[model samples]
Target: MEFSIKDIIEAGEGYHIEFKEFLDKSFVEEVCAFANSGGGRVILGVADNGTIKGTHTDNSFRSRVQDSLRQLQLYLDIEIRVQDNLIIVEVPEGSDKPYACSRGFFIRNGANSQKLTRNEIIDFFQKEGRIRFEELRNEKAVFDNDFDERAFENFLNMAGVSRSIDRMSLLRNLDCINDEGKLTNAGVLFFAKDIDFLMNHAIVVCVLYKGTEKVHILDKKDFKENIVENIDNAILFVKRHTNVQYKIEGVQREEIPDIPDVALREAIINAVCHRDYFDRSSNVLIEVFDDRVQISNPGGLPSGLRPSEFGRKSVTRNPLIASLLHRINYIEKVGTGISRIIQAVDENKKSSVEFEYNSGFSVIFRKLDRTSEADLGESSEKTKGKNAEIILEAIRDNPTVTREELCQITGLSIQGVEWNLRKLKAEGKIKRIGPAKGGHWEVIDYSC
Candidate 1:
């Protein structure tokens, strides 16, 4: 294959190479090295003068490379080709944990190769999952407008900022609104009520498809509103379709809730905060399938994001929007929604969070039916329901419970009990019997 010098130049840092006389054991070692790192090209049969001299074009040369790969512990998708008498083997970095050849584990260090110690190797694998999604920069917005007064105020409210905050100061802190009054893509996304009208590319679309087919539209809503409203509206849209149960406490306790509102809210916030606003045609899509729900946004993973890095690193396609959302408490500061969602899903003892970066970014929340012991197998012995058990125990103690009764039983405030009741009812776990005077708590699912 022909290589573009201009593309190589534009690709800038992180791309590396090693030219060889012919296919050899060391050459195979280099192939594994490139595969372990963030991937780069290896050219052969070319002189240092940038002139192609060609390589041993026999099938053996290719066989040796393939054999070396098989011998290595980790296997990944590697691309091998030849162009202009040069043997170019493309190694895609493997994500199946630590990979090693005869030299043990290795990593690319600023255009040089370095051997990884046991600790270093462990750290590398850990970091693959510890990536955050908020640290990405919007270079295009470095010199653009980055603040909207209403967006800033709304963000502060969502983030739980009680005190008054300066709009310019907040923008400067987020690095979206520069001193020149130019807005970053983030500023446009967060503040502009009609971002789609202004940026066109910043719109978020939430669609509820009848099936996988795109031709039939069961229900769809486009969010051209400001980023904050877009996030809230999208979440409400999901909640509109989502259901949950209520678990009544008393002599015969029960668990109910078709779905968790918090889970839906988190999914919506994540979709809005991390979406690739750079893609013009595509918007953030929330497709509710019969068995599973898929939340997708245009644009593949961020530059430094990998599948394993799903919930770890802070990367953002629209950094400004993320920053504002962060301040407003829509998402956690360090990008902890993924872990929180995992925790919540585990608590429900159902559902699995599936992440994909193909074509566009997608997070699929599957609807699970069972509460298996294996769901908490990681820590099976631990008490499963602090929240669920506490509430259930209180209701078991008293069936004619009021908000005050719930508070006294669960040691929570009336407001807290009300919140939990709302959540429980949303989950389909419980139902109120009658009027406040003669009303009783009705447990929905006695199975739990």
Candidate 2:
């Protein structure tokens, strides 16, 4: 939604920029391209070099453009804003449905505009629905004993799903196996014994460190497996490095782990379900520090989401993977995990969770220090410039608090809240006390 001056400068004749005196057939073609592909911007006053020449076409320019956009069959509209002396029209990407302006219909093929035939138009409209990637048939990929059976059974056992259905039958029902019986991309990622066919992009690497630096190398391992097996293995690996202390049932003593099992499960599932399978070079990574544990998955947030929106919004890049994970109890329903992760951390009286979405989505879980009661005496005001310190203090008593909650407690705005949390994570000031949905926070202030 935010456009920069560089966007205008980079604009060209096709998907980037469109020069038009008024709303015409060619303008319609540009609009259709935006609908078919992702969205794009249209600058009214610029001529390529990102010039702000200005628009003096007519007084009705805005009205006419709005009218033309409304007249389109797809009910598409544009966000018109004037910056400096230029009028910028922003067109959002439509669903699968083909868009049409007065000039027939158009679709985006890479960066160019292509006219759609009648059948193509029909097909585009028919494709308007949430595509279940798990159900898509991939007829070409071979099975050829490439799937791991023990991993498959382990996933089933962890999920507690019935074994009534055979692997092939389950695969067929999941749409990972084609009608003719072959592996889809989803199947290959989730069930493949060896991911060499895809260069092991499906693997997840985890490291446990006694300190922040990896030079010492306490323990490091890679779980090279399908999505399901990867999720299970990753959780097991994390649990191996963490210790739990539980109070005697009916006594004053309580039982607690470094991280909550439920929260950890959700974090693993979230990483596995949302990772970008398209990038064959990258794998999900989990790094443990003396103060915190960082979990990162390749390929950052998809378009339309920001680093600040994680756990708040449920915009998944791998929808089919998410659905399958949900069915297998790896992931909860959509939009539920964020709040759950927050709550888990709160109930456990740990530090809050910190998420950073940049080149990828990275989560840092801070470890708490309960041994010295003196550490708990720091004032909230003293924690200011020390964003992570204050965040840890604010969440130390309540781990389930959100960014907004942290802001409210700390008297900081949303950006301020996220800013401090990010700084804390980068400084290794915190550690996850438990899993994502039901986890607690742990502050590592003593390290710094």
lDDT winner:
2
**TM of each candidate vs. truth:** 0.46, 0.52
**Candidate 1 — what's its lDDT?**
0.59
Off by over 4 Å in 1: 1-149, 159-170, 173-176, 211-216, 251-257, 312-320, 370-448
Estimate the TM-score for candidate 1.
0.46
Among these predictions, the greatest TM-score belongs to 2
lDDT of 1 by residue, 64-154 (tens): 7677667666777777786655677777767664667875766543333455554655655464332222222444443324335677676
lDDT score at residue 208, model 1, on the 0-100 scale: 72
Name the 10 consecutive residues with the lowest summed lDDT in model 1: 6-15
**What is candidate 2's lDDT per residue for 1-448, written digit by digit as tens?**
2235444343223333455544455666777776765566666666544345677445477776676677566676568776665667788777646667666777553234556654655653453333334444444456777666676676566655556555665555444566567777777777777765544667789988654445566888888767776777888888888767667866577768767777777877778777766566788898876556788887677643545765675555555566556556666566577677677877776545787777678777776654322233323545555655567877777767666567556555444555566667777876666676787667777343
The TM-score measured for candidate 2 stands at 0.52
Clashes of each: 55, 37
Query: Against the true structure, what is every candidate's RMSD?
Result: 18.3, 19.2
